[model samples]
Target: MAKSQKLLTLCIAGVALMSTTSGPTTAFANDLPANLDQASKSANQLKWVRYTDPAEGAFSMDIPVGWQIQGGMFRFGYFDVRWMMDARSLDAKTIVRIFDVNVPPYTLPTRYTGRQGQPYSRPQQFQMMVSRYLDGQSYAELYAKHRFSDSCKIMKPRTSDWVPTLPASWKDDPGGRGTQGSVSFDCDTSDGPRVATVFVRTTVYPNGLWFAAPISILSTPDRVTLAHDMVQHMIDTWEKNARWEQYQNEMTKIGLDRIQAGFQQFMQQMQAYHRERSAAMNQQVARFESQQSNQAQQVSRWGETLTGLQDVSDPMTGTQFQVFSGPKANYYVNGNGVKVNSDVSPGAGFHQLTP
Candidate 1:
């Protein structure tokens, strides 16, 4: 525990020296507690209860009670599916987040058809690569910069001893390999300086396709110690519904088959377009492919945007809690976080939420 706090301290431990131009970002820390364990508990003591997935009870994880929650699954046109959830303290200072597991894939740009530094093979399912390969630290930093501040100059950036729940056979497979990386950075927020830590995993296949997911991110005030055990509890207590997984797998296969059929039809259309010398035909093909590329970005952007949830006050009590959103539905909640989403208001104790 002492070693954990050392890395996140205001000054670098054991360095004993200074140099200019050390990193790209820098921020100061506010004085908090010296003891890591006590600081974490006192600053953000939590009582966790299992929260099932709202969209489908496919999985459930422990979440701190009384905190605002907004998490669900994302399904885009049957080609891809992802799940993520976030829990934040009432003050909105401390936060924990989960990321999508099955995002799009990408390959290196060495091929002749490569553009934007990535190969065009399986263009509908593939995205342009910014690099041929990236290790855990690189991917974590990449995501942190994208989701947080662009300048994270203060980073104890290195691969961590953290282990992922991916099947062990993945590492043993000849065609693929997996890795884990973690880093802690000092962030300068509007209120004060805070420490943001990120953990990421990556898998690469023999065909050059790669998938990297920043699986978890936690941010707390600079002086407050991270609830390492709380984070561990969330991971250890994760429960997956077996029946849901089986049904999901069958549905996923059907989705993949549909995607394959769509790809074949797209190829035939492209061939027809090529056979014709008309400019309009070529324009139509360009529009179709461009839309696919945009879809990937759109899905990714939606995941990033979920981190922002508005606080809504309850009339029964003076306390405010974050509300989950749905299409054309209004949500009302009691002090305990139980909610009802409907166009009409609930009983006398409930108040309507604008968000």
Candidate 2:
């Protein structure tokens, strides 16, 4: 199989694992101490720093002071599908990953089939598709069936119901409406069976744009409860930067404008092509008419045909010129034969000039 196909398969499998839902084991819920609510509240007392992306200024998240942050692109084929932010503690035991998913025009799929092997017909089908992919297995059963790594042996899978309670700071934030869930398990490492917990929160937008954050922590059995608490605390502090949202809206508008402009250009090209062909036919008719008509009449008809050809040729030439003018600007001619400039800045917004 191709590399891209392999990566895609793994991604699908990960999503399937995340969507799994089965009855929690009785022991799984009882293993952890009963003071989880208090622990989560206490975790908020820890010192944290908000880390924001320096390049696009797209997002920001709060993490404990000692955690290290890293950013990367998740690519499929030659296109980037998502931006990944990873924060790991100094001990490398706890890790949180936030995936910002977006598909640009170049990479957006023309059609998508659900897990049921059929095209979706309704918005609710998405939830059904996820449930179908998971196959009704509990978190523990899913992990046991699929190991985390080549050397890792997942065992003693446990699960508990986790509901995220956002802090007062996020009460009015749109992002706070994200759906959250969690699962816990144990994996055999070099030391032994180490406890691990995973927390996932997904936010789906009305436009079908969705992003998920899956935070996983590997720790000693004794620290499992603390790991769970910290995950909740982190979620409570999650915030979407307002400037980033504004930038995204601007980008969307620019994208739509480019699409509309390109379509208009295509229609203009088709009309010009037809006019050129018609002008050629009219010139042929004029040449035949010249053989049987007076010189003045033939010249007049020929001049009209030539003028029509010139009108068609001018726009075609302008279109070709725009094609070679580089990526700095998108050029289009107005009805008055004047050129308009639509310049776009990278990761910024669009600037349009009057014709």
Candidate 3:
């Protein structure tokens, strides 16, 4: 159960961290009205551009003018990023991000005690999941590591109804039940103290699969209200492309199949390599043992040869003598003289003899 909780936290952290990077997306609609008067009519009335991802067609979103859009891949699938203005210190920046959520294969214990030791109700369980996700340990570590903030305080999330625009075919989908909520908080950051408001919309399918879109806005205290209003406007204009979603599902299946096949092939190669390495190691050990045996025999033969030599005394001269045989020569030592006789070659010395 603890492992499952950690996995859930990690998956959520991955999603949140991935959101910080930009993703793949297209430009605004070409047919948008170019007139300045029409663009300024209202925040919602601004000229909006529609972006469609070309790879899996998994994501589509409409971005307002003066904002930048970037798209990229995530573990679950693809994500889309849209942001307005540079987030310089003392300046306000609004960033909106959308990504899919995939719960790993496991069941979270529905009934768990909270930090207060009180058992959480079903609704509270869901809320706790969201709370823990937004204030993930990874997120906090990132802020600290980069000196982005001194600390963070996640406010209690407020739950509300959130309906996502899906295709007609998806209306009766099993996990079609949807919910929306937002969490607001303040942090002391290196760039200056800033307030962040995050909005999340989640749809849980009948099969237990779920998808989430979390939009975050960061700004100075004075501009937080304006940033909040901008976030609402962006949400109001948001729409999803059903065709892209279908394309994404098909492409994802194909990609997974390829990955599985590649992994199987790699494992086979690794096993064959291991077998060859083991055989080689065994052969080397055999050679080493044979060499050691030969060395021991050589030492035994030398010992026997040395043992055969005896000390001898000549009575007439009272001279003590011993003879030793080496691989190339024999040596005779006594009180009178030291003599060396070579079986193969002889050198001139005090007492040298040739074969």
Model 1 weakest lDDT span, ten residues long:
10-19
- Two-way lDDT contest, 1 vs 2, winner: 1
How much lDDT does candidate 3 score?
0.42
Runs in model 1 with CA error above 4 Å?
Answer: 1-45, 77-79, 100-104, 110-113, 117-131, 150-174, 216-218, 221-224, 259-355
Q: Which residue pairs clash within candidate 1?
A: 25-153
Q: What is the C-alpha lDDT of each candidate?
A: 0.52, 0.44, 0.42
Write the residue-wise lDDT of candidate 3 on 196-252 in tens digits.
555554444333323344545565566555445444554454444566446444443
Off by over 4 Å in 2: 1-45, 72-84, 99-147, 166-181, 201-213, 269-355
**Candidate 1 residue-wise lDDT, 167-197, digit = tens:** 2322323445766677766676665566677
- Sort the candidates on TM-score, descending order: 1, 2, 3
lDDT of 2 at 146: 39
Deviating ranges (above 4 Å) for candidate 3: 1-30, 35-56, 59-243, 306-355
> Which rank order by lDDT, best down to worst?
1, 2, 3
lDDT of 2 by residue, 244-267 (tens): 556544543444456456768999
- Say which candidate scores most in lDDT: 1
Residue-level lDDT for 157 in candidate 1: 44
TM-score against native, each model? 0.52, 0.46, 0.40
